[model samples]
Target: MSEIPRLSKERMNGWAADLLVCLRFCTRVPIPALSFEKSTPEISLAASAYMVPIAGALIGAAAAVILWLATRLGLPTSLAALVTMAALVALTGALHEDGLADFADALGGATQEQRLAIMKDSRIGTFGGLALVIAFLARVMSLAVLTEQSLGLAVTVLIAAAASSRSFALLPLYLLAPARTEGLGAATTDLNERLLTITGITTLVIGLLPLFAGASLARVLGALVVSAAATYGMVVLTRRLIQGQTGDVAGAVQQVAEIATYLVFTSRL
Candidate 1:
């Protein structure tokens, strides 16, 4: 381990600084001279996972603002919601979408090693291309429905869904052995307890905020219950199918969580 920085001043700042680096890595955010001493892999994973909700919150806020503007401009609610969804995808550079596609391709493979090999190929296979289309359509449809019902609720769902998806992705990090010695999976294979705790707290707070905005708390709680179940199920299934987790598995978790959130929201309506 590297020399520990002063805990009093550096701990919180270190977390924030690490999060910014992750944001820059995942998104296009330009941050300045950020450094991490040899922190535990768990810490890095948790920090990266924690950013998902924060980023989701920002994206949700932007979506809400955009929808509000569109409504004021006399656009239909569903159309406004569609535009907002497009903007969110554009902002993130479809990073998760690409992940979802790659995961789909991997899953479509006939064998475990073959699946991992497919995921690493970079070229989108037919399964991947189709999965991307379906995921996007599902997201857009869900947003449109929610916007028609309540813009505020739609925004909350969007943010919560994003955060929870990333939280779901973190489960594989905690439970699975990395498949190879490269990529994000390798970089985050040894996360620490402190980092995991931080991520859990952040994910919970973000995931529940929608409940205060006219969404039923009971339904939100139910969604979380389902998400937890799904996470466990995915972990078990992936272990059996692939012998370990990889970047594709992480992507699948996020995709499933996003869909689960939408399903829970729809049930409440």
Candidate 2:
């Protein structure tokens, strides 16, 4: 009986540490120094996987608040959408954006070896520039459309997309082997299935929040299907292109999944 309480307390402490790790992994939010003294960043990442959707929701909420404030100040929907996107980029330090760019640049390479080399290069190529422009435009247009329909719709969808896309992005991390000896992919590949299940359920619940705000069930379901298909496509493409997964591939998955979800939300159907 004595040991049982101690074990429960220890489990709670581990969970708290994992939450901090998840936040630090996904956002630029500041945490206390004492938090780090008890946690190992890389090792704790997999344990904290279930909390990743929550972290993404936090990012989305921050951006959504900015969107709401800008619109309240009478900013044009388009401009407000742009500001919201800028805040998102700032919050995540453009981590996924950078990865998408690198992945795009790698697409121009003719061989696996060349592709990997291109991905490592810091320079942006024509393909990467085009990818960024097109992706940014699509996201802005989608948000602007939602804002025009209703602020509540826009906010709810944004939070849902941010949370679910990150959860879907983990599919590649789990389904494929790391492309290299060391990196984010290798570090996070060893996931706990029980935790992954928790992550998926948490994301699904958050993704369904738009329904409460009067979104059509078909629309939400369609968005989820599209996001899943998009993620699946990334998995196949990465396997064909590099024969394995990398951090950039995972980032690209998140980016595409996010856009796919937004597109479904804004569609006529």
Candidate 3:
């Protein structure tokens, strides 16, 4: 009994520490160091990967609240959806969006070396600008359509998409070698299958929430399938382009998967 209690406490402490680290990595949410620095053992980014869905859900919930407020204020559904997306971008510091831009710009390069160089440049290219505009339009339009149908469904889908997309983003980190010698992809090279499985299971629960909230089961499952396919396509493309994964590749996967998910959720056919 004593051993069981101790083990339970240790697991809880570890979980809290992991959640804090994940939130800090994925968003601009301020978490003071004093909160976890002294309370738990040092946790690696790979170890904290499993907590990403929780962090994503937190981000989505914040955006969902903004969506609710915007809609309630009598804003047009399209405008409200745009405002919600803007809040999502703000909360995440446009981290994934930046990745999508870099990835797009890299595609214009003729060689792997040139591609990597392009991704490293701070300035956006024409391709990058176009990619951002298209991605933003897809996301906002999908949310608007969903919002028009059922507010509750739209809210749940946002949370589910956010959580599942980030979970899928972890695929490249675990499945491919780093494209470079350093950076987030390299830092998380030790990401293991067990951690990914845990994350995937957590994401599944979140993804199903919309179904429980009266979303169509077939559409919800279809959304997940489409999202998974989108992430896989990104992984394959990244491997062919640069021979491995980068932080930008992971970010691109998230953005693409997110868009695919939203489109499926809003699809009528």
Candidate 4:
């Protein structure tokens, strides 16, 4: 039998290290290097999902800053929003986009067995392509609207939307059991109450900090409110489809909520 891994060292490292693990797992962004030996420990990875939103916020801020600079350099709103969205996809290696595609493909599968199998296949399908197109267009168009308003507004929307979407993405994890006995859903069952509280508060505070910094209160609230609605939709879809959650469902939640946030921000309040 394989020797059981100990959480003793993992417990010792605490939040900072866990945050690093979250960064490494969630994105292609470069981070300060952790020591070589303990970089990919299962124990650390298991707990690190709690910090997914923190990673999302950092990634969102970076992409937003890039978009702001492009506009500052006189790029048109459409062009700047385009570049920013591309950067967003690259930063996370399109992690959430791929999930959106998988879940979309699952929609056409007609059975749980077929859907799960399609999700595992590397090729994209018709539904997956359409999902990506809609998701891409929604973000770019909504962001273009915000960019026309102001760079600060654009940045706030992106940061708040991305972070809050990511925060709620973990809901499927908390509410539904894993669909599989292996892979990310199975590996990430260690989100204890204290850890959940930490991430939830971190998501809230980080998501709301820009508001105190003078972001449009109504727009920010709109984004989060719509994101919550989107998350609920995802929960219902996932529970009804698979009776539980998978990594793809979690990713779809993030992307869907993100698009919903941007949509709300672009609406007339």
Best by lDDT: 3
> Judged by lDDT against the true structure, how good is candidate 2?
0.87
Clashing residue pairs in candidate 4 (N, C-alpha, C atoms within 3 angstroms): none
Q: How would you encode candidate 1's per-residue C-alpha lDDT over 1-269 as one tens digit per residue? A: 24455554566765666566556555544556544534423345445565656765665666667777877798887787678778877766777777778877877788988888888888998999998888777877887787788777887887788777777777887788888788777878667677677777888888897787788788888888788788888889888877887777787787778878877887644
lDDT of 4 by residue, 1-269 (tens): 23334455545455667678877877886776667435545445657767777777888899989998999899999999999999999998998899999999998888888888888787899999999999999999999998897777778778877778887888888788988897767767766677778777887776675575466766666667778888998999888888888888888999999888877767776
Over 218-255, each residue of candidate 3 has an lDDT whose tens digit, in order, gives 88888889999888888888889998888998888899
lDDT of 4 at 204: 72
lDDT (C-alpha, whole model) for all candidates:
0.74, 0.87, 0.91, 0.81
Please report the TM-score between candidate 3 and the true structure.
0.97
Error of 4 at 31 (Å): 4.3
Q: Which consecutive 10 residues in model 4 have the weakest lDDT in total? A: 1-10
Cα deviation at 201, candidate 1, in Å, is: 2.1
Relative to the true structure, candidate 2 reaches a TM of: 0.93
lDDT of 2 by residue, 49-143 (tens): 98889888888899999999999999999999999998898888888888899999999899999998898888999998998898999999999
Error of 4 at 157 (Å): 1.8
Those runs of model 3 whose alpha carbons end farther than 4 Å from true positions after fitting are 34-37
Model 3, C-alpha of 59: deviation from truth (Å) = 0.8
lDDT of 3: 0.91
Question: For residue 32, what is the lDDT in candidate 4?
Answer: 69
